[model samples]
Target: MTGPGRRRAGAAAAVTAALLAAGCAGEPTPSSTPEDNRVFTNPVIRTDAPDPQAIRVGETWYLVHTNSGGRNVPVHTSPDLVAWTAAGDALPELPAWADPGRTWAPELIQLAPDRFVLYYTVADRASGRQCLGRAVAATPLGPYRDDSTGPLVCQAELGGSIDASPYRDTDGTLWLLWKNDGNAIGVDTWLWSQRLSDDGLRLVGTPTKLLKQTEPWEGSLVEGPFFHRHDGRLHLFFAANAYDRATYAEGYAVCAGPTGPCVKAAENPILRSNEVASGPGHASMVEQDGRTWLLYHAWPPGQEGSTDPGRQVWLDEVVWSDGKPVVKGPTQGPQPRP
Candidate 1:
């Protein structure tokens, strides 16, 4: 979900000003070096990095998040997940069909060593609804380009589609998962999936409706759907409830395949609001040294929708016990680096 509007340049400048102030006070400035520490705290990225999606290329990790600071897709890089530095805009230019300042939930995937595909949500001016678009880049931090005259996916009749996430199966089949913007029009919000072409440029088959909000804790909607494969089982993880409230939390379903017959866990909302953080959701998994880490955004407690330090990036471990996933956060204390 998008946070309050703020320019990216302004945010960077504010951070710089604070660091300079600390130096003037004879305090040691924080280091960006990944090896500076063995333990890390919450809000790994202490800025407005909402709806974060990350990928590891070699030893460096690259992250892209919702439009802010006047970038279509703001990109950041790190030697380790705890310390991040701004890497500039990934999609510097939006397609002809998209309206500016509304880009959100960018999902990055690598098809080859030099080929990267980004699926992102943008406002469709003609349809007056949010839609999905695709872009390509040669490197992880890209000046990715989209030359389409129209959106790649625009379910206008169902209030348009958003939150496009791509998943690759064990058999090498590519699938795209997203949430229908039904909440925008007061309709039932359903998570849908479809097959993607090998090139990652287009959808190939009919869309399948996976699941929708049914539980009370989910409130009226479910959004930000992504797939994770663990121990030969496919799990569909998603965020539910209102994005701006403390009730916004994350849940998962055990799917038989990418296109499921899926079942939500009885103990749903596995990762949720705690004393340390509020509304922790929109997560993507990264595996390092055989351990899985969830990279997500969270609102600072008592500051649910504030623009300052809005939706900072948080890292938590995901442990599997008896084949069920468990989140070990929103941890306030320092913990081992991923």
Candidate 2:
């Protein structure tokens, strides 16, 4: 809800106002179309793709995510969104400006085939400089780098950080959706966006506020913003509530275009777990083999801490229509549906 230009994820700030935003239009949503939307084939990739990001390269589906290991985010590829194999870590060297926290929330965009950009949050928890950085590799999986001007976006104090999802509309104007939070240190947390320079990296227009506050079911945390185009509308999917509690959820929002005053649907918590996994948030969508699937992290019923690297990856078939996504349920593994 601010002016446009230089969009930065603020650190340690307060909410500017109550986010009382709602959905728009009575026009029929295309997410309801029976042909474009199909019944999902179960459990494609089961490896932990925390805050996963994906790109469709030709007939192949490639996925990458926040570093679940000691290094950068890892990339995995598959044909049907099921039966995946690891390619490699996206980045190997720790960014010079990066802190001990390594990297968080890895996002990928296919600006063109064989030419892709991987963006992530590199935080030096000690120095407290949370930065948004980029790495470019000719292939989907590679040894990506801090190839940008160091940080595409950075906030150090209380709310300084990164996690970016880029969108380009039919008009050719590119947009970026990222998290902003840090009220403890005067930073504000919400969804923010900005126009991109022709290259798709530099900030062009001013930052626009799209979403804030959130549904009560989401508790207090809001993060992991992923967007896609469907039936002429833009849909936003994000993780919400606390990270270590059962109340965590993956919610959704929809807009007609990139620059929205976007809207959240009442039927949120699109992908949530009431079982032992505490909270299940931070998600990404992959449109593969004539269908859509969702990837995110959950406690998996037996884990207790977030530091564990083997958080079991869960898959769900997403019903994307009407500018919104609906998750049928979680798949146990790669078994043929009955």
Candidate 3:
């Protein structure tokens, strides 16, 4: 565990208007800071930051979280995983193709030194169906633009889709994994993946069905897919159950390839609610200093004096034993910073 160390201008300072380009609206707002980052604990941001996906650029870590119906995607940057500060919005302006006030679960990746791609979920006005779309930017924090006035993937027949996660194989093939949202139509939400062009802007093949909410522990909903590779096998981690419910948890599947006939662990939901937090799900994984860490969201224990709070981000270390991933907590007490 390390302290926040030295602070830099990019993340620790306020974003100026000149840093943003056209279509993006709003000046950067300051994020409230709490206790010293030298020795921090869990619930990293201490505020609502759900479905967080983090990307590392040198020593700095940038995180993007879901902002349903918000003007732009919220971004946070941390010198150390334990101490985070607000950077700015990823998309200064919402994509024109999407209905106003409909953005959700955003995943940003760098394709080249100056090329960046953002994958997010939004809704269509005609069908009111949530779908996945793409935006491009010159920098990590940016005024992103959706060049196409359309979605990259929208399966109206499957009740629409969301939570666009990406995986680049060792061979340089790009693959996208997402959940076919069937919850609105009284059907099971399913995880699906398809190959993409090297540019990651176009789908290459028919989507492959990976997993469904069949396990008793998975409850009625399963969304938020994030992928990683370990021991030469692909691991697909996803959030399950209604996010507001106590049963919300994190489960994973081990597969042979990017899109696969995956096998869910018999002992499912590697992470779940404990005595302190009620709902813990929608996780993103990052490896730092040879240790794997999981960043997730959970509703604080409702009876513990919180006012029915929404999901807030939490961080914990993950240890792999016997080819399985184990999370250290839903820990509420203070511990060493990660």
Q: Please report the candidate that would top lDDT against the real structure.
A: 1
Compared with the true structure, what per-residue lDDT tens digits does model 2 show for residues 58-154?
A: 7776777665434467677765554456665678776666654346677787677667777777765344655677777777776765644367776
Cand. 2 Cα-lDDT: 0.60
lDDT of 3 by residue, 258-330 (tens): 7788999887888988887777878889988888889887777762213223456788889899889999988
Per-residue lDDT of 33-92 in model 1, one digit per residue for the tens? 356477777777777778899999999999998876667788888887877777778998
lDDT value, residue 337 of candidate 3? 62
The lDDT per prediction is 0.85, 0.60, 0.73
Q: TM per model? A: 0.92, 0.78, 0.86
Off by over 4 Å in 2: 1-48, 124-127, 183-188, 276-278, 302-310, 320-324, 333-338
Clash pairs (backbone) in predicted model 1: 7-69, 8-69
**Per-candidate count of clashing residue pairs (backbone under 3 Å):** 2, 27, 0
Using lDDT, rank the candidates from best to worst: 1, 3, 2
lDDT of 1 at 269: 96
